[model samples]
Target: MKVGVVTFPGSLDDVDAQRAVRLGGHEAVALWHGDHNLQGVDAVVLPGGFSYGDYLRCGAISRFSPVMTEVVEAAGRGMPVLGICNGFQILCESHLLPGALVRNQRQKFLCLDQRLRIERTDTPWTAAYAEGQEVVIALKNGEGSFVADTETLDRLEGEGQVVARYLGENPNGSLRDIAGVSNERGNVVGLMPHPEHSVEELCGTGTDGLGFFALATLAAEVFA
Candidate 1:
C-alpha cells in the first residue's frame, strides 16, 4: 500500500506522518501542496501543521492549495483520506466533513496523550480498532474545539458518523466530546488528535497510534 503525505508551506508534521506510513508497512510518498497529481497513491494523509503560518486561520489558507483540488475530487470518488489536527481543520474548512473547528474553550494550546474511544471501526483507518476500545494518542492544537448546530450534532450521532470521542474528559471542549468524525461514506475522516506522533516504539509512548496508518492492509477494498 502507498500513502501520500502532503507538505504545505508550514507543515511541521509531514515527516512524522510519512514515517508512520512507512512503519505501517506501506510506501510513503511525499506530496507537495502545489502538485497537480496524486502520484497514484492508494490513500492520502493530510498531516497536522501550521500551514501558511496559521495565517488567516488554521488550515483556512491551506485548503485552497492546488493539491486540494485533486484531493477533493478523489474524496468524491470514495478514496480514503485521513486528516489530523490542522489537517482536520482544513477538512472542515473545505467542507469535506460537517461542522467547524474553533479555538479551544480554554483559549490555550494543549499537548497531551489523549484517550479516545473508537466510536466506529468500519472506516479504513480504524478497521484495526475494536468499537469502544480506548486508545491513547498525542493531541495538540489550539483551535481544536469542534462545533456544529444542534441538528447537525444530532444527525452525526444518529447516523454514527461520529468516529471517535474523548474519554474521561474533553481536552478542548469539542462539542459532544467528538475527537474524530467521518463523512457519510466513511472514506473521509478528520480527527483532532495526532496519531502519527505516537507510532514509534522508541519514542517512549506506546505504539497505539499505528492504527491510523494500518489502513494499507484493508484500504484496497475501501478504495476499490
Candidate 2:
C-alpha cells in the first residue's frame, strides 16, 4: 500500500513519517500542501509541525491547505487518515474530528516519551494494537489538551471513539487522559503523540509506534 504524507510549509515531521511508512512495509508518497491531488495513495498521514507558524491558533491555517481539501474528501469516502500532534489539531479545525486541542494546563511546551493505553482497536490506525495495550511514544506540544462538550464527551465514550488514553500521569492535561480519537466510521484518527519518532529500535525509542503504521496495508482491505 502507498501511504501519502502531506508536507505543509512549516511541517517538521513529514520526512520522518515517510520513513516510518517505508519501515512499516508500505510505499511512502510525498504530497505537497499546495497540491489538490492525493496521488491515489491508500491512506494519508498529516505529520506534525507548526503550520503557518501556528498563527491564528494551531492548525487553524493549515486546515485550509489545498492538500487538505483532497484529504477531507478522501476521508469522507472511507479512506484512512491519521493525524499526529499538530495534525490532530488540523483534524479538529477541519471538522473531520470533534473536540479541540487547547494550551496545556501548565501553559508550557512539553516534550517526552509518553505512555499511552490503546483504548480501541477497530480503527484502521489502531487495528494492530490490542485493546488496553500500553505503549510509549514521543509526545511534544504546547497545545495538546483535548476538550469537548460534556454531551460530546459522553457520546464519544459511549461510542468508543476515544482511541487511546494517557497511561501514567496526564502529560498535557488532556481531558479524561485522552491521547487519541477516531471518527464515527473509525477511518480517521487523530493522535497527540509522534508514532513516527518511535518506529526504530536503533533510536532506542522502542517499536511500539511501528504498529500504528504497520497496519496500513490492512486499511485498504478492511475499509474497502
Give a tens-digit lDDT track for model 1, residues 36-58.
Answer: 89999878999998999989988
lDDT of 2: 0.92
Give, for candidate 2, the lowest lDDT window spanning 10 residues: 214-223
TM accuracy, model 1: 0.96
Clashes of 1: 0
Whole-model lDDT per candidate: 0.91, 0.92
Query: For candidate 2, what is the total of clashing residue pairs?
Result: 0
**Residue lDDT tens for model 2, 65-153:** 99999999999999899999999999999999999999999999999988899998998889989899999999999999999999989
